[model samples]
Target chain A: MILWNIWLTQDYFEKQNTILTYSAVISKAYQKEEVISYEKWSECQNYYTNPENLDFLYSIPVTLAILALREFSDDISRRTET
Target chain B: MSIETIAKAIGSILQDTYSRNYGLSKGFNLMEKEIALSSYHLLMRYADNDEDKNEIIATMIHMLSAPFSDHEIDKITQYVREIFFKQYPDEAKRVWLALIKYSNYKKANPSFYRYQDEDSLNKAEENEEKFVQQISSDKNLTLDLSEISLEKSEAYLLARAFVITPYDTDDKDFSNFLNHILPIVIGDLTKVEDYSYNRTRESRKFHHESISDIEQYLANLFLEANFENSKSIFTTLVNSLSGNAQRQRFGRDDLFEFVSTTLDYFVLKLYDNGNLKIDP
Candidate 1:
């Protein structure tokens, strides 16, 4: 779960700074039917809601990931506005 | 299933998650460049001798070249050269000779300033392209060397002497090809170790040796390349430089002059082919 959070944070940082909009793994996930949305993020939400998807410890990383992404996005937005 | 089962599941989940995200990258190119340079400095601090320094430098270059532009590689190489030159003259010369990236990027911007990020690299590339297009392309300078008729004259003989000429070719065509290639070759010859700086006997000998090496490379390249014009006097020059025929005994200054002229042909060919070397 700690490792998953780190990976998510790294992914967010890469996307925020890069010129590329989409990543291939996300596309591959969608192609494999592991993700169903064009945005490639909808599967995570579905997993969160599904009771059968009970890796309860994984929630810790998932929550931290959401908060970190929000803070990062907010920081970028504030900087851009300034 | 108790604590052991839970730990195993966690480990499995972590491995799966990390594996999925392993190749997710974009901005990492700039990050990778930064890391490579920092690693070089760290390596330099520990490098004991000239051999160790050169081996590490070469390893660093081989590792990072895939992720960076040709210009970026040259920039890093120049930095490494400056650092190595104080202690390792021979190793430095080897590195300088081997660096033959055929781009007008350096000619466009001579500064060795490091780019801060991807934005700056892109901006530098844009500015360089604009500069190169302005300076290089528009001249449209056409040469008609045959009209000069320097046939059998010292200038013609001097130029002709450098040419490999293993096979037969039109004298006029060979002259025209040589005329096209000499300038770029001379520019490169003077770059590694400027012979004019001291004008001493030793420097002249060193320069001559360097030019011979350059000529060997030109010979090798001409034999390797698939030229569009097969019937070109280039074919004759290529065959001569092919080094397959009996090696000609060329003296000091004459060898330098001839190799300089011949290598210029190779240089022009390389420059023309530079467009095909797409950046990462």
Candidate 2:
């Protein structure tokens, strides 16, 4: 099932989407050192297919971005549900 | 946390994901919870308890989802503010600042640290620097992309291909050599599907061309070498070609680099085994 999720992710990214795959997520985890740098993580996530070069991509991030497209708020009082 | 703990969490999430799949007929059943859960699986490895694990994972997923949104960033800030801030103010402050830094960094440059390993990236940079140095010193230095006359380059063959021309000096037939040997070396590969470097246009082209070039170069090399069991290796590469061809879609420059690097190492093996047949 983990492998299946990974395959789906590879397929999704290969098709040029942002949805994270399991393998990519693991690869991202491999990148996180002392800090959780999403910038570094995003840099590693590939949204295309390239079998000869797999090192440039990783396997994790958000999928809710597909749905929640809201304006960025400034005040903490104007932000969040949970 | 222990690997067993993380594995257990993964198992639980997989079960949740599995149960979610019952009603869906065509599309996948993955939702925010599942995606968030999977993303946190990495952070879950750091969790000492389920409570902290769940909260941290939720915060990470939320941050990942709306990385740029002040609200998402605040949600994580809130997580730090209410929970850790009260318990460990210093640590909480550090984390909160780190979170903000991370969010800003993502917004500013969503693409950094794309390298597979620092070592390789460093080596590539060093090679580039040396290439510039050499080109500066001897502007006449052109790459030798011919068949490489294996006997003449026996020293280079014995060492790494980099010892001769480390840069993307396209003059050497190293790429072609890699292309030739990969079909034979394909057997030792455990997971061909891991190749997912497809980031940019040039990288994708390299990935696709690398695989396609390998097949083409190997066929040419086989015909040229005309070894005793050339037919067997030739047949094998052709048989294995379909998988790589399919993998070409997932190819990237690093994947091509990987193939090239693996070829550099494996060619030595082939030579020692007398399979490379370094004649003429």
Candidate 3:
């Protein structure tokens, strides 16, 4: 079960990278006079399919901040509840 | 001589050696040397076979393996040796043979010899200092994220990625839903401070919720959006939040302020790209 979850996380990260790649390509094409090709879009999709690249790309601080905010929110909720 | 007498003789020899060679006023140093000498002496006695030598040797080895301070070593050595060696000349030849054999065995076992060496002792001392420092730095040291289980840490990280991502929807209700869930995602990544009220008074403000709360909320929202179904909107949101947080050391108010600003920036960017519509 744990192994399955880890694999799932890896999958999510890969998909995230695909989105990143697509955005990058679209943005670049917008600035360039050269025509964007379907081949480049396909390349971006291929990059997203690979999970290994996204492992190091995950952020720590954002996670910590979100956790902090969640706690603050909970405290606010508790205060209101009381 | 009896085993007790032999132990006594060894103890006396060590005490005399400590007094004669190392100054007694250096109490800790003298005690440490006494323990080492007594340990060697006990092992020697076991090999001599005044009694069930193997059992005695095993017990002594276990004792030596335990953590011992220099002062405790001195006191314990005195008791161990005195209890073991009481009779002397009659068992003298056996004691000598035991010492020789044991010494030879130790020489052959290089690893064991190294473990009992001064270098190993010094390394143990260094490790003890590091442990003390680690404990001292965070009174709630046991609950610190660095000390948490890897699974929890990873869960927290995943939740964090989910919360910081700005949600965009053509519908107002869905964006509001994402905003509402964001706090729960943040909660899952926090660790509870374990110090007393006075000690952790500062940290108490941080540990109100479990990391899973935020993680589960963000995960569900992401899944609802078919995060994989969309292009890099989710990834960009995670990256933006992470990037901003990394660039600044935020104060208490800064967290809320940063999130608001980040949301505004993303909304503007998405609106310019014609991918998002704002009702304001």
- Say which candidate scores most in lDDT: 1
TM-score of 2: 0.19
Q: Rate the local accuracy (lDDT) of all candidates.
A: 0.37, 0.35, 0.36
The candidate, 1 or 3, that scores higher on TM-score is 1
Docking class of 2: incorrect
User: What is the per-residue lDDT of model 3 for residues A1-82, given as tens digits with 9 covering 90 to 100?
Assistant: 9999999999887777755655555444533534455455335434434544323333111121122222333442233222
Q: Which parts of model 3 are misplaced by more than 4 Å?
A: A1-82, B1-156, B160-181, B185-252, B275-280
**Best model per TM-score:** 1
What is the DockQ ranking, best to worst? Answer: 2, 1, 3
Please report how far candidate 3 places residue B134 from its true position, in Å.
32
For model 2, the DockQ equals 0.07
Q: Sort by TM-score, best first.
A: 1, 2, 3
lDDT sort, best first: 1, 3, 2
Cα error, residue A32 of model 3, in Å, equals 15
**What is the C-alpha local distance difference test score of candidate 3?**
0.36
What lDDT does candidate 3 reach at residue B148? Answer: 24
**Which residue runs does candidate 1 get wrong by more than 4 Å?**
A1-38, A41-82, B1-179, B182-280
Predicted structure 1, TM vs. truth? 0.23
Query: A1-82 in candidate 2: lDDT tens per residue?
Result: 9999999998866754433443444433444323324443333323322333232233222331211111111221123212
